[model samples]
Target chain A: MRLITLPILMLSMFSVSTFAEEHVVSQKNKSFSENKISINVGDTVHFLNKDPFFHNIFSLSDEQYFDLGSYPKDESRSVVFDTPGEIEVECAIHSKMFLLIEVKKSEDN
Target chain B: MKTLLFYFTLLVSQLSYAAETEPTDYTFIAGHPSLQQWLLPTPIPTPKDNPLTAEKVSLGKMLFFDPRLSGDNNMSCATCHNPMLGWSDNLTVARGYKSKALTRATPLIINLAYNNLQMWDGRIKTLEEQALAPMEAELEMHADLSQKIALLSGIDGYVTAFDNAFPDQGVNTKTMAMAIASFERTLISNNSRFDTWVKGDKSALTADEISGFKLFVDPVKGNCAVCHSPPNFTDDGFHNIGLASFGHDNPDLGRYNQRRLNLMKGAFKTPTLRDIALSAPFFHDGSAQTLSDVVEHYSEGGKVKTNLSPNFTANTLTPEEIASIVSFLNALTSPHKPFTLPTLPQ
Candidate 1:
């Protein structure tokens, strides 16, 4: 019975460790699909450009700074949040395109 | 027969409703509720970092009117952005320091508070950043900010004003910019006949003007609303509207210089149509002499099609429709009122 329980515990731990989440944020009609979102640290955000024009998504936030340079429609760029803090994201070309992400420390961490 | 009639009525009603609400198929019906979004909100947007105050406005007004801000101590901001000429110099292109002609026209300061980006190229992000640009530029105001601060610090009136505006911040370049930007924010326009028409006033515009508004929104017609969006009459986006100057050799690559994007080549920021009638000699190159000329330019789909905006296309508007659109533009200008110049501190 002890041997059986150890195998089950190992399988559960393996599954949990492999489960990193990804969120898709679309740039549609010159606006972000979600203005604000909350995610756990280590979660990756994929920014998909859905508009006809080119979009450059970037964040100058102290918590995480990244510039996903201009890409045409249907293209995407992603970034992983390693730090637990809020990040203000915006499009470099379209000034009005703005988004906020609040990253919390993961339970696993 | 009765069932068929009912279905037709339902279909017509749904189409009308969609046309009213959807910007994609925008249609202008008198006193439509959907048009109210064009009215400028009463509360202006100010950054959390630089919250507006009465002291800041007062100080900013003084700084804006002071020619001493310039290196030569002659030209003030008001020299080019004259309040009498719709906050523009009424020139084909702005004459900079020592009467040197600049490439671009002096954009009107009307409804700038609503703009997401500033300048013809959308280079400056905020008014605070824009306020000091002309003052520091060699061809423009040509003043050394540190030297200007020292001069202002020497003046007792300026020192007291700066102290009141930015307590403990003292007389510095940052405080001066904040103050000037604060004053500039007060230059807003939302009380036009067009605004009144949007606010459910059926009698605000004439029948011709109303017809012109329809053409303005129609995608196949003038389609002016595509770029000259409602409320402030600007999308705050850059576009190469196909001016003749764009065809020239080594033309000014407006937004391209900043972004280096192929689409941005020769593109300039879309100026607000609010009080546009007063800010004559229009376009980034100051090519269009009148509103009629501007309409014709759009109707022709631009002279230089090298990098024309996707929104701009050859429009087949009749002469009457052109006149009507021009008439509609006239309704955008608010009725003039007396403006008292700010008194400069000695």
Candidate 2:
């Protein structure tokens, strides 16, 4: 009974890691699926390139600004959210394609 | 039977090719009409009220070149928008009729057909409306409409053209703007190496040039497409790409001056990078001189931050890569331009 319970605890821990790990903001169908996303400061937001070509994930907004310059099709990038507040993400290639990420302050941090 | 099937497939493919060969309805592409393209969302639509006419366009062309429309002989609409200088005088700040009042001036006409709103502030709605500002502005063309109209009416050529162009409105400001704008409409740029490349011509660009184009369009490399987008090559949206002057003691609060939208504090309309190599000194102020300098500016992000453009991230572009991007920009120039330099009517 003890062994079975230990295995169950480990499985639950694995599931929890999968949930809170790098959250993907995919580029698909010509726009970001969800324009606004919420995440804790420590969590990473992965810019997953699901488009046919490439995408430049960059921003000028003060909350968070970094250009993950062009990544090819099917490539993915992860940025640990060190900064908190409203971060604007945009494709350098597709001007109209823009997104806002609300980076919440991590209670632990 | 197999040969017959192959022939049928060939015939179908040829027919589809023919259908696709029909020129796009985008006016920025010379012969094509601009009603369909521009920045996709901000397409310029003729007021369900004002459709196009060939005669109106012809008349507008004549009016655009005529200096009699100005209050002072020192300036005409063409004075600032000279064809020789890519329709812009290449000044950081435009001079008045006597080169006095220093105001920023951009190109005369770009993808106007696609713009839902006109001018930096989006104040003017129609070409006809935009036509009056220069003539009436104290420091611009500086002309009173009453005298200009009388002068125009006396000219037999102008009278005849106006009579033919607008049976009801004649050569009033609206008709005049319409005619001039129609003429401007004809000044679309196409047939660049980039256009050829887009149409599947493999030999249109060199290796470096192609890579530069890729960088311009790619999200990671140059990321220029965010504002200077494709097809007609303009987004018609506003951004504050951190131009240095924004942080000045007296800051120009760009679009925010109008709407007061927080994000628009230093935001200004995104200029098309199409034919960028030909149009000197980038930005609304005509500040940056060379294309490489322009790239370097973006690479370092914007110079100032007072009301900095939210899109301003320091785009990292290398020197050799910058040269290649410049070459690619040159490739966007139209091989065959529509309008020729007019011998100014003395």
Best model number under lDDT: 1
Give the CA lDDT, 0 to 100, for residue B259 in model 1: 64
Interface RMSD of 1: 18.7
Q: Distance (Å) between predicted and true CA of A6, model 1? A: 49
> Whose TM-score is greatest here?
1
lDDT of 1 by residue, B1-346 (tens): 4333333433343234323334644446656777876888778888888898999999998899899999899999999999988899889899988889998999999888889988999989899999999999999998998999999999999999998889899999899999999999988878888888877788999999988888887778998886787667776777888888988888999987876556678989988898999989899888888999999889888889987776566788899999999999989898898877777777
| TM-score of candidate 1's A chain against the true A chain | 0.81
Q: Could you give candidate 2's per-residue lDDT for residues B1-346 as a string of tens digits?
A: 4333333433343234324321222222322333223223332345555566778767776677777788775577777777767777777767876668464656546556655456765556566678778788887788888888777877787877888888867767677777777776565566677766655566877888877866776656776765565556655566677777676776666665654455566667766555666668677766788888888888777687654444345668888888888888888776645565443322
TM-score, prediction 1: 0.79
Scoring each candidate complex against the real one, what DockQ results? 0.07, 0.03
Segments of candidate 2 deviating more than 4 angstroms: A1-109, B1-48, B338-346
Rate residue B116 of model 2 by lDDT: 44
Deviation (Å) of A54 in candidate 2:
17
